[model samples]
Target: MKAIQAYRFALDLTPARERDVLAHAGAARVAHNWALARVKAVMQQRAAERTYGVPDEQLTPAVSWSLPGLRKAWNAAKAETTWNGGRLLVAGRRYPSSKTCSGCGAVKTKLALSERQSECEACGLVVDRDLNAARNLAALAAEFDTAGSGPVGGRGADRKTPLAGQAAAKRQHGTAFAGQTGTVPPQGGTTNRVPVQAY
Candidate 1:
């Protein structure tokens, strides 16, 4: 016999900690909803295409529901959203802009909302929080320009889905299994091999 053991622990969080936890949960909910909406839209489009007699190969590419797939899609969309005109871009939500130092590029482990200014320990540069964040974003854009690479949206010009007629062919119409007539008797059995009649 095998035995299984389980343990549960309760968390006692402070007000700030509780808020942080809630914020993370809210962010997760938003991501989930966004992915769900994308999936639903694709499905609806495919269904509509089917009603119009569009072949399977012509339907929209299916959205992946796996965690990594969803994460990749989310990252691409977030990158596109933050992108502005040439060379100027805003950081995505995941970027710790305000917590990052514009002078030395050092990132603080924690930055409270009440902190209006950012002070870097490495370079000893003190600046307004928002200004520091903006500077960091500008630096990122400059780095991209120097590297001869545009932002994420500018790259990956290829279509995410397959082109028309590139998808797998539709399944053929027929019985999928070989035992449609009924079970066969053993080779040496005495029972007659009469085909079973369907009602």
Candidate 2:
């Protein structure tokens, strides 16, 4: 059996390269914030529609917050910036980038956003939090794509493009209702139903 291993090295970037990298990071942050805003807006709209007694079919649909979902929206909006046609290496939201130590592979129980450095109790190693996370992520990608073929596919790329002018499907309503018993009429008629059970 062939064993798999990975390693990461710190980049010695020129001043200009450092600046360019920083700019790209800033752009990524902006894109993330923008996607979050869109998701939140759709959620708020759906909530408001439900409060206004809008029919389930008539309510504005919800947007996905998954990496692929966010990537799709980001790709659609990429034209707004100079970053286009680039492969996106999105780590899973639940991946503990900051909590894992790159030196000894010890996982921290808790890490706060205010802490700028990661101190591993097991290894007694002090590393800049963000740099440690970046190293860990690079190793993760290396291990995930063992062949070093190219960017991993079928995550964001394979998702079906949402229809234009139509919102994504609303998975659930804020107003909780049990036992899916209501069905829309075929001839476009409203049916009187029991009030929803609200928390």
Candidate 3:
């Protein structure tokens, strides 16, 4: 007969270290959710095309679900730029960089793309549209560096996953009971028991 063993250990992480770990976890979740959403969107599109009597060959192309494929897709979608030395800074696509005035910190409600210049109504500062956007992005990069945070809040930050915090709150304590561990038995298999000390 063969035997299997498992071990668990807890780390004593400082506040900053814990925050960094949590940030990494959150980023992973975001990436996973983004990929999942992309897949689902493609599936829905294909289904709709089928309903419209579109031939399989004419339907939207399928997305690759493999790890490498997902990673490649994510890399293409994740618009990031190198800052300082090698640090990556990501600015949200929805940010009104071109419509925002670099001098007065004013955002125009409606700035036509044909307009090559951004004229600030609040401060009467006129600048090239691309130049204004560049300044705003630079300011955002500086702010991110100083705060040591992910993206800034406002129109630039993505929406949080629904009920994510609530789900985490419910699992504030360890899932397993003290001094015991639990595992879901495999199909047609007996429950395996293990004994261990709790922290």
Candidate 4:
């Protein structure tokens, strides 16, 4: 009822491309951990200063976990310099397509590394791998489509963060994402092109 539509971006990844994807993921993870550490450290420092009732400016700078900061960090990561994996466009925001599911709108749920295909038992959806996640992110992006939220993936704020931590089940990304697009991806995604897992 909320102007729901599918958002999908296709990435052309070869074995080399796959490596780049992994690299981008690694860079993102590093930035996240680094931001967290920085936040914790600054918080500690601020608490210590609080003993003397120091003012806000006197405290160490708090690490921002917003989306812009994350993009800046990722872009600056030397490891990911050559591996700029294309970002998935959801609603209008960018998100990690691999981690989320296309079937049930879950976030960061574990999909075995070996398990390229996503099968959503809860929704009875069967999906490929990449496309499935892409569609999931798309639906999530549209959750607040009317809110007119700006690009979500750019800043440290994940576009899908709003849907964080409620994955009781896994729905393949392509399970329904392909349907959103009008035509289903080839049965079993072609190696050259990532297939739509959910239908």
| lDDT pick, better of 1 and 2 | 2
Q: How well is each residue in 1-199 modelled by candidate 4, as lDDT tens digits? A: 5663332222433676456545655566445556767667778888999888889866655657556788787666733523333232324344646656565655555667788877765676677887786676666656644434565433434333233322344556545343244545677553334333331
Off by over 4 Å in 1: 1-90, 146-199
Which structure is stronger by TM-score: 1 or 2?
A: 2
Among residues 3 or more apart in sequence or in different chains, the pairs in candidate 3 whose N, CA or C atoms overlap within 3 Å are none
TM-score of each prediction: 0.30, 0.34, 0.34, 0.25
RMSD of 2: 27.7
Q: Each prediction's Cα RMSD?
A: 27.1, 27.7, 25.1, 28.4
What local distance difference test score does each model get?
A: 0.66, 0.67, 0.67, 0.57
Model 1, 49-156: lDDT tens digits are 999999997787794555678889878777664452223345677898888898888989999999998999888999999999888887777666532444454444
Model 1, position 75, has a per-residue lDDT of 80
Candidate ranking under lDDT, highest first, comes to 2, 3, 1, 4
Error of 2 at 85 (Å): 10
lDDT of 2 by residue, 1-199 (tens): 9764422213444677556655655556446556777777888888999999999877775735556788887877664432432344568999999999999889998999999999999999999999999999988876765333444341334334443432355556432234446654454433543344332
Worst 10 residues of 3 by lDDT: 160-169
Task: State which candidate, 3 or 4, has the greater TM-score.
Answer: 3
